[model samples]
Target: MTGRPRLADVAARAGVSMKTVSNVINDFQHVSADTRARVQAAIDEIGYRPNLSARNLALGRAGLIALVVPQLDMPYFAALAGQVLQAAAKRDWVVLIQQTGGDLTVERDALAGRFPQRIDGLILSSTAVGSAELRKRTDRTPLVMLGDRNYQGAAQHVAIDNVAAAAAAVTHLAELGRRRIAMIGSSPGDRRHPRLVGYRLAMKAAGLPIDDRLIKPVRNNLGEEGEQQMTALLAEHAQDPPDAVFCVTDWVALGVVRALRTRGFRVPEDVAVVGFDDIPYGRAATPTLSTISPDRSAIARLAVDSLQAQFEAAAAGTAYEVGEQQAAFRLVVRESSGG
Candidate 1:
């Protein structure tokens, strides 16, 4: 014998069917008192313990909520995940993490009832997938949305006001007397990320003349993407370059700093920089980054609390009230803004 007790073995030892043993273990009323006693005796004799995963599967309730995100390697998401875990622990809810790599198909699949029989709820941190697509499959599950995706109240979402946050970051730089400000991570019509919208509003608010050359569009939201664009910008505007730059994410800002160093531009003195998503690296960089700090812990709190509301509404046979909830944000002043 492998010395590991299985449900079938327990059933055989008790002279009962596997289903009856399952019922006995679960305290299903269908099992007779005599049968329950016999199953208990067998379990004790065999030192058999129920498999949590198997038990959860048989009951169709795992007490597990899913946290789906783009990538855990991203510092912001990793930090968010840690907060979500602590938040879930407070409610005695177990979390199963899923990384979809920000793929639309994977995001869609997460809401497609694949775990309807296992997971009690799901929280998705999405960067892509539109409202229509989210609506088609999300209504059945108790789901909470996170991050900057604007789904127009399609789901219960907890996020920061990206437009306002970005504006705040830029306003901080402008206050520092930096006029020629450049922006990276500009995707003109990508509503999934609202940084572009925020940048435009902030520039206009500061009464700074918008330069088309300063708005660099990055197809990828990675450090290298920012580095490549910043390098080119350095070469293009050697004499009359931008005095400051804003990036959509801290990862991009790190690259911008790298490129600036390679091009011999002193941070804050020559080019003030601001980034969003105050990642860990932002603080430790050569010139610590000034950034808009979205309250991630608050997002985790509101999201978990919101999901609890989702579950309660479902239990009461009422409709889940969905809305766009913006958590607080603040511009964290560090060496990068020279503030």
Candidate 2:
């Protein structure tokens, strides 16, 4: 009635033992429904919140997980983080977010468990990390890879099939009779990007000419980079501009749209556009963006579920095998692509 309500207080209020109150709080299945209901009622009446820290300590856990991404400011990552937070919350866990700025050292540090405090697990959307570094990780923290980086057997992973998703986007453009299709967001000298491969494969399959000038490369997957690249493409091929463009991200697609409007090119008329990651902004854009929509909520759920499985296995002194999970995705057509 005065200070923070304790387990004993709830037990007293419910006319039950402290052990019964603890079992109810921990969600142990042995407790009867009637007793559980009484304990919950008392908890609600007394406004007694379980001491999560103490409970987690007793269970040898932190009840907190960290999500490390290349850039939290990116809309895709921000949206994914929100999904992870919601999924973690359902399991009575808290999420901490960290950004790596696409630095390999920072990503390596995260894999090595160099955080200031102990985290029960980690979900990493890595940009520069490689399988070698992943294999070299000695940290005991349960790890779940989030994104298209292929560290397959080294850790548990959840991601959409980038190549297939990209191909689907490009194919959609091709189906719309856009032969001079272009791609943005490929990095020069970086061949590991599956999206780039997808674009090429789709172009070839569609019997469309893969003009080198139309395939633009950017140092970053940002709106500004997309705009800059589109401008360069238009300048270089002023006589023959791409009929459609597939951007690696929604932000980039939005930028391409802006650049097209500036050049007096109509969307899906003179130039159609498609982007990946169905970020909320794409829906509200002047000409709603068409994109490859990865099931981010499913990805988050899988990643968290994988980590929780590992945690449970460790607690039970059992071995947990790591594996990869493919999250579902689809090509969403919109006004930008003449949907």
Candidate 3:
């Protein structure tokens, strides 16, 4: 019954000490669940709110984290960002998003801590930045890599196993009796893309011929690129089109579907198609996409936790070894793949 409820009010209402209330507020794992629930209930009943700014100030942090992505428009990145935001909110942390447009200079600037405001930590999903550039980072901000890039122990990382996930997608197509399974996301002269390697490996394992003409390279992993490349593939292989196609992203798969429909080809019936990143649109499309569903929530939680660990280690003046965490993924068969 006060103007502004405080921590002591919660403690008094919960029949616990101020330290216990603080522990509950901080989400300290050592606290018992029953005590934590009592403190939380008390806080809710009393309408007690902790001063996050003051607390972060005392902790020598801004309580802010940055999520750097290549493109915010991409459904997968947007979904991942949403997951990261949810994870950060559980810790009472604010997230700042930065888009680099997959530009090397912009990505490098992000790695160098060039942001609109100071951030306590960073989670970057970069393909343009490499391990050497990552090693050149001069800032002490805790950082976690959030994609399939091989940082080579240069930083903490969280991602699904792209190679395995891609292989699984192709294997699904192969098991469906699709002999000519085409891929639509290879970059010219960039042989290290795990998905591309997986596509090739899956074709060999299935005893299917890896047709170079069917393996189209694109400038980007966008719907437009997929449409263009699919058109080209159709023209080049008009006599014998691919029986199935594996796209790098759900967006690309959508475009492939469009091209196929425009040419009077039916999905799964005439040519099966699979994509990656199970975005909502893919699930709602005319013929729902079969795709690789990476555990985005797990990746976000792992990335944020890794950053928090680094922050704690730095504050304690302890050495923190960088880590690579592989998030889980699964193949979701849908209408596009005749599921």
* Candidate 1's TM-score: 0.80
Which of candidates 2 and 3 reaches a greater lDDT? 2
lDDT of 3 by residue, 234-332 (tens): 999999999899999999888998899899899989999999999999999989999999999999999999888999999999999997899999999
Candidate 2 lDDT over residue span 1-339, tens digit each: 899998999999999999999999989999999999999999999999988888898779888999999998899999999999999998888998999999988888988889888899999988877787788888989999888778859888889999999999999999999889989988534577889888888989998877766777878878899999999989988998899999989999999999999999999799999999999999999899999999999999999999999999998999999887999999999999998
Please report the candidate that would top lDDT against the real structure: 2
lDDT of each: 0.85, 0.91, 0.90
Give the per-residue lDDT digits (tens) of candidate 1, residues 1-339. Answer: 487999999999999999999898877898888999999999999989888666766555566889999998989999999999999877667888989887988888888756544677889987687777777763476888887768887778788998889889888888888899999998555544577778778889999987878888887668999999898888888889999999999999999989998878898899999988999999998889988899999999889888778876877789877998879999899997786
* Model 1 spans > 4 angstroms off: 1-61, 188-193
Could you give the candidate ranking by lDDT, starting with the highest? Answer: 2, 3, 1
What is the alpha-carbon RMSD of candidate 3 to the true structure? 2.2
- Top TM-score prediction, candidate number: 2
Candidate 1 achieves a global lDDT of 0.85
